[model samples]
Target: MPRNRPLAAVLTTVVLATLTAAVTTAVTTAPVAAGTAGPKTVIANLFEWNWPSVGAECGASLGPRGYGYVQVSPPQEHVRGQEWWVAYQPVSYRIESRKGTRAQFQSMVIACHAAGVKVIVDAVVNHMANTDKSGPGWAGSAWTHYDYPGTYQVQDFHHCGRNGNDDIVNYNDRYEVQNCELANLADLDTGAAYVRDRLAGYLNDLLSLGVDGFRMDASKHMPAADIAALRSRLSRPVYIVQEVIYGAGEPIGPLEYTGNGDVHEFRYGKDLARVFRDERLAYLNNFGEGWGYIPSNVANVFVDNHDTQRDVPGTLTYRDNGIYALANAFMLAWPYGSPTVMSSYEFTDRNQGPPSDSAGRTNNSTCYSGGWRCEHRWPVIANMVGFRNAVAGTGVVNWYDNGWQHIAFGRGSAGYISINDEDFAVTGRSYRTNMPAGRYCDVIHGEKSGSGCTGPVVTVDSGGWFRADIAAHDAVAIHAGARIS
Candidate 1:
């Protein structure tokens, strides 16, 4: 049941204005602290895997790897395997999905938190379960298009005639996107009083469970004003990221959700993929505004997402090669939107589930075992995670470039990095790093016997400059805290 419309609407407005104003005031008044840098680079996309698996995987992989957060798949109750999109067809605000039981979900959340990694659940509140579908969900809830007897029923859905077409043809038309069905999924009347109460209850539940934020799916498919309304009713400072995939000239782009939260900068991944893989390395220095990108702080950058990995063609070509290393390395090194590194399991067919048994129980793919390849476990990618963590809050100072295929930059005085992707060896280039005089460890290619680092000491003199050679097809990162500097 929905809540009172007029009152809910008024409350929502007040919340949005207060939260937005508070954040704005903080940004304006707070001076930059010495070590309190800008954003950090540690984000992970949790595919549609179960809770136990997520906990086990994050504990074993991401937790130890020092990822700042893990963006888990939708946790709402949904139709079970009517199609993969069934998850998009949310049935109710229950923590029971294909992932795991409520207890398991809570355990995963606790485990991730204990490991110093935050959890961001993929929220699908824009609409509800698709109409006319009948199936039992992970929570044993049965749903139908027009009727949900004794379970969950929303009578205010748009009439059948209104959503006759499949694609949303009008970008400027806000109502059609917000009130219309997405991919034939049921549309909820968010303005309804009962609906607002239920949705807010669900969000509050997640917050109580120690979840950090949300990655709103198909955000463009909803009305920005309504989203703003929904966000306001929640507690202050909930990290919200919207998925609005747009290219250069798309009329309805991410700007619509500017004040709401960070919008997914799909263009960054596409452009970075091309430049890092096929083009010369010199093209990297002229990043950020040179490539016509949104400011780094307001964007959520990724190399590939679930939709693009499965649907978009030509976006991801080198999922198994050195190009992946170079592309991800550049994303971590460069100042961009909050970066999210994808951790995928190898699959011959796009729709195939994670490594599973004959009875359909999902299981982990071993690193040494030849069944699946977990890209996050790769040495190059994992090492870069450490580099990004070490250089947190530093500006890109002392950028050096030997034309294309050779580039270098330092992050505030904390860390310095250089890369060479050319076919031949590149050397004899140096830059000012601004660190104290002493030797520091190069995170990449250095020895890591214990939990910390050792080897490849970089000596930054009193002049704040150092000389280093960049090997072909490889990258190097040096930090201040590891070695005496």
Candidate 2:
């Protein structure tokens, strides 16, 4: 069903020489930042994999790929059900849940750490367990409406009702948001002394197990003051990323959490997806600013996340877009935000459990197997992982675009990339690629062969400019240090 196009004739040797010369001149003369660390790109959206499955799948696959970190599923105790939402219901601070036992979770943390991949746990501390009439949770912990046995009780929650619903409805009212139930899930009072200590203890426990940071869910529902206080008590330097989904005009936004850690750049993902998939090429040149973007360094960008993929109406479907693969390639190639790539299993319904058998047991399905769809392993997507690591910390320079179909750019002379999304061939293009004189690999199309690239070797001459022709619906990336000039 998928067809690969041939290299365009316009990408001739003569044009490449000219572009390479221009690129070199620009880079060599530009002023450099003192001791500036190059881009550190991290690609992870560790989907619905429970703890054991994460260890089994991510530990071995992501580490050697040079990923800076892996975003894991929530490790707290959750409700017991055949549906996926059960995990969103937090009953206790125990590491034990349906994903795996405590030992399996710890093993995954250790394994990922050993492989050079930092682990960021999804923390649902904004609330306690849901008040469902169901008995106990997956961890066998008894739970009441706002009471968590042996952990916390309803007295720890703020007693407030809005329109006959006990849940907090006032977003403008910060107090209610932090103390009210989210989707009927029991809300915890982070300001409470005992609650703060218990949460800190839970976080400290995760830190002891080698967790690098956290993804705070339902963060918009928590008060900024309380969150900062809690963050102060936790292990310093934790990679804290808060989920404050602010789109268009929702009032509450990500700005409140910037002091705590990096906030999810939800708007960036939507804008980029639109420009890359539906809009014209002219819109992409100002990619960040064109959409009222955030500072690239702090934004956590992704094409489509678990929640949006499932709930957003009329949005781009992941299955329809071979575009997802292309989007990820562009994200990795571009030095924009701290990128996160989603790794998900196939499901018929939005609420269906992950790759599980009839008994509701999570199973490790192999590639081409019926249940799991490991998009991360796709050749195009997997290869970009290496590309991101190779050019980490480099700023975008020598940017070029051909109409709305093709885009080419370089990252601090460390790497250069070209992408073509049109159906027709592109020709006569020379752009500056500030890398030194050397032969480099086009990673998108070629695998690393020995010390140099085996196919599509981009040679930067004594000058900086080079001619580049990209086939329709194709992408090519050239990185430094891979070949001899």
Model 2 spans with C-alpha error above 4 angstroms: 1-40, 168-176, 312-317, 452-455
TM-score of each: 0.82, 0.86
lDDT of 2 by residue, 136-156 (tens): 776778877777788888788
Model 2: number of clashes?
Answer: 24
Q: Candidate 1: where is the Cα deviation over 4 Å?
A: 1-41, 82-85, 131-133, 149-154, 159-163, 170-175, 311-313, 365-372, 447-462
lDDT tens digits by residue: candidate 1, 39-119: 334787766666886777666767666677888888878776523455677777788776667888899999988766789
| Cα RMSD to the true fold for all candidates | 13.3, 8.0
Q: lDDT values of the candidates?
A: 0.66, 0.69
Quote model 1's TM-score. 0.82
